[model samples]
Target: MSEPAAEAAAPAADNKKKKWLMIGLIGGGVLLIVLSVVLAVVLSHGKSKKGQSKAHDTEQQAEEGDAEGGGEEHADAEEHGKKEEGHEKPKAEHGSAEPEHTTETHKPAEGGKPGDEAALKAEADQLKQDIAKLQHEMDQQTEMLTLSDEAAKLKSEINALKEKKASLEGDKQKLAEGVKQIRSGEKKCAISGNPDKRLDELRACLGMSQHGESKPGEHKPAGDSHEVHWSYNGENGPEFWAKLKPEWKVCAEGRTQSPINLVGKFGSGVPALSYEYKSSALTVVNNGHTIQANVAEGGGVVLDGKRYKLLQFHFHTPSEEQINGRANDMVAHLVHKSEDGKLLVIGVLLNRGKDNPVLKPVFDNMPGKASEEKAVPNAGFDANRLLPASRNYFHYDGSLTTPPCSEGVKWFVLKNVGNISPKQYDAYTQLYPYNARPVQAVNGRAIVEN
Candidate 1:
C-alpha cells in the first residue's frame, strides 16, 4: 500500500512540474517577440526622424545662403514655401503613428504569458526619448521654414528696388535726349528777330539767364559752343541773338526789356522825385558805345520814399525810347542804384536847338580816343540842372538798351525836351553815329505821365 501511494504522488508532482515549465517557456518567447518588435519600431522611428532632421538642415542652409547674397537661393526658398504645407504632415504623421506603435508594443498578447512590468517600463522610457528627439527635429523644421519666409520677403524687396533703379536710369536717358534736341533747335532765336517765340523755348536752347540755376535732373553735355562777342548787325546782331552768349540772352528773352516804346495810353500821377545833387568831380569817356560821365558821391535822388545813389550818366543818339512813336535827337540816361541793389534811370530827351550850358563841361572834357578817361575837377555840373525846369515827366519800367538787357529799371523821362546845339550834336555823332538800340514793344507795360 505505501509503494502504490508513493508512485501516484511522484507522477502527479512530475505532471505539475512539466505544466509550470511550459507556462514559463511561453512567457519567455512572448517577451522576446515584444522586445524584438519594439527595437525594430524604435529603429524605424529614429531613421524617419533622422531623415526629417536632414531635410530641415538642408532648408536652413539654403535660407542662410540666400541671406548671404545672390538671388538664386531666394528663388529656391520661395518654391519651398509654396510646397511647405505638404512637409508638415509627415512630421505629424510620424508623431501620431509613433505613439500608436508605442501603444501597440506596450499591449501584451491575449491568451499568452503576462508581460514583465520592469522591462515594459524601460522600453517605454526609451520610446519617450525617441519621441522627444522627433519633436526636436520638428521644431528645427519650423524654425527653418520661418527663415525661408523671411528670406523670400527680403528677396522681393530687392527685386522691387532693382526695377525702380532701372526706371530712373531710363528717365535720365530720356531727359538727356531732350536736352540734345533743344541744343540743335533754332539757335538764331537767341536774338530778337522772332519776338513771337516764347522766352522759355529760346532760353532752353541757349541756357540763358545771368543767375540761372540748372533744373533738377538737368545735365550739361560736352562740346558746348557759344558766341562770345556781338555786334549791331549781321550774325551777332539782334536778329541772330539765338546763338549769342548765354549772359546776354535777355536781349531776346526779357519781357520788361529796355528801349520799349513809350506810346501807350499813359496813366497820370507820376511819383515825385527829389534830387540831392551838387557839382563834383566828373570823368568823361567814350566806351565804344556812347559818351559816359562818371560822377563822384554826394549825388542821389529820392523817389517813392526810397533813395538811389547816382552811378553814372550816358547818352544814346536818336533816343532809344520813342515818345508817341517819335524819337528825339539824343537821350541822357542817368543810372542809379538803391541801397538794396535796385536800379533807376533819369532820362532827358534832347532836340537839336541851342547850346546846353550844363553839358558844355562834359563835351569839353570828352576824350578823342575810346576809353580815354578825362577827369574834370569842380565841373560845376548838377543833375538837377540837366532836367528841363519842369516837374512834369513820362515814366516807365524797362531794361538797359544794350547787351545783357536786364529789366527792372525805373525810368523817368522829362516830357519837355532839352536843347543841344548842332555843333555839340555833331561832336557826339563823330564818335558814334548810331549809338542807340531800337525801341522795343511795350508788351503791356504802363507808360505813366504826370
Candidate 2:
C-alpha cells in the first residue's frame, strides 16, 4: 500500500506544478503587454502636448505680426488723412477710422483658443489683402485728383491764350483797314494827275458847300432837308466823319487836303496878292462850327489880276497851317470868292502880344448859342488892321480844313505873323478846345512862297 500511494501522489503533484507554471508564464506576458500599452499612451500624450505648444507659439507669432502690420497701416492711414484733408475731406474721414477698426480686429486675437489660431491667421491674411487693395484704390484716386487739377490749370492757360490771340487779330484787322484807306487815297490822287483840279472834283463829288447844301447831281437831292450832324468828340467826331454820309468819303480818303506842313522847297511862278479893305458892318454868328463874322460884301482882294470879294472871316485856335513846321497860337481866315465861283483864303497867323483893338469888337459882342447870329450896331471894323506890316506870304492849293473838307481853294499864309492879346485868344478857345483837323499829307503837292 505505501508504494502505490507514493507513485500516484508524485504524478498528481507534477501535473499541478506544471499547470501553475503555465499560469505564471501567461500572467507575466499579460503584465508586459499592459505595461507596454501604458508607456505608449504616455508617449502619445507628451507628443500631443508638444504639438499644441508649437501651434500656440506660431499663433502668437502670427498675432504679433498682424498687430504690428495693423499698427503700421493705421499710422500710414492717419498720415494720409492729414495730407488729403484739404482737397478730399471724405477720404480723410475714411482714413481716420482705420486705427479703430484695427483695434477691434486685434481684440479677438488676444483671447482666442489655440485651435482657432489657423482661422485667425487666415482671417489676418485676408484682412491684409483687403487693406492692400484699399491702399491701392486710394493711391489711384489721389493720382486721379492730381491729374484733374493739372488739367484745370492747363485749360485756364489755353483760354487766356485764346483771348490774347483774339485781341491780336482785332488789332491786325484795324491796322489792315487803315492801310487800305491810305492806299486808296494815294491811288485816287495818282489817277487824277492834276492835284489842284482833283481837289475841286473831290469836293464837288462829296456834295459839300459853305452853305451846307449838296451840289447838283452829286449826292442826295438838292431839296433834301437832311442835315449832317457832327461834333468834336464822341461818335460824330472826326474819326467817324467819313462814315456819316456817303458824300463825305473824301474827308477820310482825300490825299491832298488842307492844314499841311509848309516844309520843303518852295515852287516858282507864285502870284502876288493885293488887299483893298473898307469898313463894313460886323455880323457875328455861331454856326455850330466856329465864330464867323460876315462882311458887307464890298471888301475885295486882287490875286494874279483877279479880283475876289471877301465874304466872311473866321478864327481858329492852334492855327491849322504849320509854318516851317511850327504853329501859332491862333489864326484868322478871310474867305473870298471870285465871279466864277472860285475860292481864295488869306490866313493871318496871330500870336500872344499887345492887345489888338481890331479884334475887340468881334470878341466883345460874340454870339453865345450855336447857329445864332447877332449884328453889333455901330461896330465899325476895318479889314486892313488885321494884316501884318509885311505882305510876304506862302501860298498853296489845298482843301478846306473842316468837313466836308472841300478842296481847290487858293491859300495865302502871311509870313509876318500878326499879334493878338491873350484875352482875345482865350475868348475863342473857351468854346472849342480842339476844332482843327489833323494835318493832311502833302502827297507831293507844290507849295509857293511870294
Candidate 3:
C-alpha cells in the first residue's frame, strides 16, 4: 500500500510543477509584447515631436531672417531720408524680438528602456501630451514672429511720413521769411512818399539798384521838398495830379495853360529874342518825368523889352505844343524867370533827322535813375548853341505846363525846327515813352508870329 501511494503522489506533484512553469512563461511573453508596443508608441511619438520641433525651428528661423531683412531695409530707407533732410537718421523702436528667437533652440529627449506594460503605456501617453504642448508653443511663436514683422513695416512707414512733414515745415518757414522781407521793403516805400525814388533806394538795398535823373522844382524851400507823387498812368498819374496836393490844384481847374495849338490866324509884331548866353559847366538830371539840363546863373534872354533869366530846360516826346494842329517828334522847353517871379518858356520843335551837335554832351551823359544829377565839370556848354540863326518866333500869354499850372506866363515858340538823330530820339523814348501833357484850350488867347 505505501509504495503505490508514494508513486502516485510524486507524479501528481511533477505535473502540477510543469503546469505552473508554463503559465509563468506565457505570462512573461505577453508582458514583453505589451512593453514592445508601448516602446514603439513612445518612439513614434518622440519622432513626431522631434519633427514638429524641427519644423517650428525652421519656421522661426525663417521668420527671424525675414524680420532681420526687413529691419535692414528699413534702416536703408531711413538713411536715404536723412540724406535728403540733411540730418542724421533716428533709431527704430518697435518689433525688436528677433534676438530672442536666435538664442532659443529645441532639443529632443535621450533614449529610454522598456519597463512594465502599464507603466510604459502611461509614459508614452505623457510623451504624446508633452509633444502636443511643444507644438502649440511653436505655433504661438510663429504667430508672434508674423506680428513682429508687420509691426516693423508699420513703424518704417510712420518714420517716412514724419520726415516728409518736417521737410514741408522747413519750406513754409523760408517762404514766410521772404514775405516778411517784402513787407518791410513796402513799408519803407510808404514812408518815403516818393514811390519811384523809394523804390530805387529799396532796389539798391536789395542789390538791384539803377541810376539816371532830374529835379522838378529847385527853387522851393527845403521843408517843402516833399515829393508830390505823379505819373503818366495809374492812380497817381497826371489825371489825378490836381488832387495830390493843394499846390497842384491848378492842374485840373485853371485855364490859360501852356502848350496851346497854333491854329487859326497868326497875329503880327511877334517879338524877337535877344540872347546873352555864356559858356558854363553843364549839369544834367533825370527827373521822374523827363530829361533836364540846368544852366548857370548868367544866361538871360530879352523878349518884348523884358529880361528873363534862363533857369533850366527839359524835353518832352511828341512835342507838348502843336503847331497848326500838327505834332513833332519832340520839344525842348527852356524855362526862364523874371525878377518879379514871372515865368517864361521857349519851346523848340524837334524832328528826327541829323544829330544836333549842341545836345551831344547832355545826351551822352544822361542819368539812369530818378532825381539823379550828374555834373559835367570839364565840359563847357554854351546856351546860344540851343538857338537857330534866325530869332523869329511866335509869342503868347500862357500858364506853366507843369503841375502848378500857374497863369500869366509868357511863351515863345521858335519858327525854325531843330533836328535830332533817330538814335537820340529812341534813347530818350526808351526812358520815357510819353511824357507830354495834353494840349490845353486856347481860351481866346492871341498868338503873335513874326
Candidate 4:
C-alpha cells in the first residue's frame, strides 16, 4: 500500500462525511420549522382534542428521515473496514444526516407550497372569501328593494298633486264665467229706468222683465193678472188652481159652478137677452191663462130687464161649454158688470167657417208675453158682432169659471153657433191651447131657455 495516497483518501472520505452531516442538520432544522407551522395551524383552528393526527404525522416524518439515507457517505464508509463500516453506517442511520432527495418529498411541509393540510387550508380560505362576496351581493339587493319602494311612493304623490291642480283650474274657469255674467246683467239693468216714485225697474219697463222674475222688494200689480201665476198644462194647470191660493177655495168647494153641459130638456118662461153693443177700441192682453180683450164703457146687454155693462171679452178654443156632450171649435165669452157690482157672462159658441171682420184685430195683436197689454187703436170691435143670430139660449145661475170662483153670477149660453175662420181659431190656440174648466155637475139648478 502507498502511505501518502492512503492518507489523502482518508481526509477525502472524512470531508464527504462532514458534508453529508451538515446537509442532514439543515434538513432537521427545516423539518422543525415545518412542525411549528403545522402546530400553529392546528391551535388556530381551536378544534377539540381531535388534533392528535398532526402529531402522528410528525413521528412518521422523523422515521422516514432516519431510514432513507443520503448518497456517497455509505460507499466511502464501507471501503474503509467491515467493523468500521458497521459503526459508521449506524452513525448515518442515527437521523443526524439526510439526503437532498428526501428534502424534495418534504417540500410539501412549507408554508406556501401544496401539502396535505395546506390544500385544505387554502380551500377553506377560498370558501370564506366566496361567502363574504355573496353576503355583500345580498346586501346590495336588499338596499335596491328599499329604494324601489320609496320611488313608487314618490310617483303616487306626484299623480295626486297633478289631479288637485286640474280641479283648481276648473274652479277658476267657472268663477271667471260667473263674474262675466254678473257684469253684463248689471250694465243692462242700469238703463232700464227705475221710476222715481216706484222702486221696480222691471215693471216700469212696460212689463218687459227680461229675466222673467222680479227682484226682492219689487212691486207687481195685484189681481188675477200677476198675483197667481198659472198655465194650462203642468203643475200650474187648472186642476191645481184652487190649491195655489187659500182665498180661491170656492173654485173646488162651490156647489154651483159654470161650464155645465148645455143639453136642455124644456123651455121655461125666461126673458130674451137685449144687447146694446157699440164699436169700441180693441185692447188685448195675455194674462197667462187666456187672451183677454178690454172694451170701452159703451157696450152692454139687458137680461130679464136688468141692465149690464160689458167690461171685457176673453176667448177659448174648443168652447168651454159642451153642446150635447160635444164642444165646438171655439167660444167668445162676453163678460159684463152691472152698476150694482153684479156679473153676467154670455158664452157664444163658434165654429170654423167664414172669417168675421169684427174680431180680426183682437187676434191679430195677441201679445206673446204675459202681463204685456197692447192696443189696436183703430180696431172697432163691436160686441154685437160676436153674438149668434138667434138669441135663443140656455140660462143658469152659476159662478165665475176661473179661480176665485165667486158664486151668484148669472150665465147665458147661446144655442145658435157663430162662424169664425180656422186661422183665427189657430191664432188663439197658439198662446193658450187649453184653458177651460171641466164641466161641473148641475146640482139641481133650473136651466131655463129664453
lDDT of 1 at 186: 26
Across 42-85, the per-residue lDDT of candidate 1 in tens digits comes to 64454443333222211221222334444532221211111232
Taking all chains together, each candidate's TM-score versus the true structure is 0.49, 0.51, 0.50, 0.51
Which digits, one per residue and each the tens of the lDDT, describe model 2 over residues 225-274?
Answer: 24565655655677787898887788888877888889878987888788
Tell me how candidate 4 scores on lDDT: 0.66
TM-score pick, better of 1 and 2: 2
TM-score leaderboard ranking: 2, 4, 3, 1
The CA lDDT of each predicted structure is 0.65, 0.66, 0.67, 0.66
Worst 10-residue lDDT window for candidate 2 reads 55-64
Q: What TM-score does prediction 2 earn? A: 0.51
Model 1 has how many clashing residue pairs? Answer: 8
Ranking by lDDT: 3, 2, 4, 1
Candidate 2 differs from the real structure by a C-alpha RMSD in angstroms, to one decimal, of: 24.7
